[model samples]
Target: MRDPILEGALRRVRDEKARDRGRRGRLRAATSAALAAAVLAGGLHLGRHSLPAHRILVATTGSTRMTTTITPADGWVRLHAAVDGIDPGERCTLVVTDSHGRRYVAGGWVAARREHTDLDGAALVDPADLATISVVTVDGRTLVTTTA
Candidate 1:
C-alpha cells in the first residue's frame, strides 16, 4: 500500500521535472535565434563596409573612345576598360602612370573589330597616386589618354 503523502510528493517532483525540461527547450530555441540574428547582422556590416571604391574616366582621341573604371585595393588598382573604334587585329596596351612618372602596363589585347572591346587589368600603384591612364599601340602611339 502506498502512503498518500509520499504519492503526492512524487507527483510534485515529476511535475517540476516536466516544467524544467520545457524551460530548457525554450532557452535553447531563444539562444539559437539570437545567434542567427548576430550572424546576419555581421554579414550586413561587412557587406556595407567592404565594398570596393570605384571611379570612371572617359577619354577620346580622334576616332577611338575609351571608358575606364578604376577600383582601388590595398596596394594596387584594378582597371576595367571599354574601348571602341579600334581597328580589327590591332594590338593595344593599357598603361597606368603614377604621380612620380612611373609607368605600369596593366594589360594588352588584340582588338576584335566589335562595337566594344572590354578588358580588365591591374597596376601595382595606389589609386591615389595614379595620374594618367592611356591606351597605346605597340609602337608607342597613344590611342587615348585621360587624367585619373
Candidate 2:
C-alpha cells in the first residue's frame, strides 16, 4: 500500500484546476466590462415598440405548481394527469373562454395527458383565452382560465 507518487500527481492536478477557476473570474469581469462599453458606444438602439409576452401560471394535477419562463404565449394552457389513476372510460374536457366572449375548447385532453405524463406534457389553453388564467366551475365541472 504505497502510492505516494500517484497521489501527489492527482493532488497537483486538482490544485491547478482550482487555481485556474479563481483566475477565470478576472477574465469574466473583463468580458462584461467590454460588453457594457460596446452598448454605450453603439447607443443600444431599439424599436419603437415591442410585443408584451403574456405571463400565466400553470397548475396541474399532482402538484401545486410550476412555471414556464417568459415565452411566446401563443397557445392554449395545458393540464396533465397520471395514467395509472385514470379510468379507461372516464372523460374530461378543458374549456377556456376569454372575457370578450371568445372560447377555446380542449375536449378529451385528459386522456392524452395521462398517456404522456411521464414526458411532462401540458394541455395548452387557447391563445384567445390568454386573457384569463383562473378557475370557474359550472354544473359540477371546474373550468380553468386566465385572470388579472
Candidate 3:
C-alpha cells in the first residue's frame, strides 16, 4: 500500500508538467500565426498596383476619402488624394473590384500634398459601375466603398 501511494503522487506531478508544456506550445504557435498574418497584409498593401487597371476616386475633400465616380466612356479619369500627412518615400494604391471579385489596380504613385493624378487609361469602365472599390496606402490603411 505505501508503494502504490508513492507511485500515484509521482504520476500526478508528471501529468501536470505535461499539461503545462502543451499549453505553452499552443501559445507560441498562435503568436507566430498572428505575426505571419500581419506581415502578409503589409506586403499585399505594398504590391497593390500589380493587378490590372480599373477606375477609382480620391475625394479632394478635407481628410480626403476615396470614392467612386463616373467618367466618360472613353477619356481620362482624374484621381485626387491629399498626401499632406503622408511621409516621404511613401506610395499609395487604388484598386477596383468587379461583381465577380476580380481586382483591377487603377493607380499607384508618390506625390506632393494636395496632388491629383490624371489616370489616362484606354476605354475604361466607369467607377460608378464597379461592384466595389478599395483604396490602400503603403502603411496598410484601406477603405472599401460599394456602389449602387
lDDT of 2 by residue, 25-128 (tens): 88999999999998876664433223346444554434222232223334544433222323333354344455576655433433333233221233354444
- Runs of candidate 2 with Cα error greater than 4 angstroms are 1-49, 59-89, 110-129, 133-140, 143-148
- Please report the TM-score between candidate 2 and the true structure: 0.31
The model with the greatest lDDT is 1
Provide the global lDDT of candidate 3 against the true structure.
Answer: 0.54
Q: How would you order the candidates by lDDT, starting with the best?
A: 1, 3, 2
TM-score of 1: 0.65
Inter-residue clash pairs, candidate 3: none
Ranked by lDDT, the better of candidates 2 and 3 is 3
Q: Each model's RMSD to truth, in Å?
A: 4.2, 16.1, 16.8
Q: Which regions in candidate 1 have their CA more than 4 angstroms from the true location?
A: 1-52
lDDT of 3 by residue, 1-148 (tens): 3698889999999999999999999999999999999999989986763433544443433444444543433332333332333344546666656556666666776645543333322214443345655556767666334352
The better candidate by TM-score, 2 or 3, is 3
- Predict model 1's lDDT versus the native: 0.93
Clashes of each: 0, 16, 0
Measured with C-alpha atoms, the lDDT of residue 148 in candidate 2 is 25
Error of 1 at 127 (Å): 1.0
Q: State the C-alpha lDDT per candidate.
A: 0.93, 0.44, 0.54
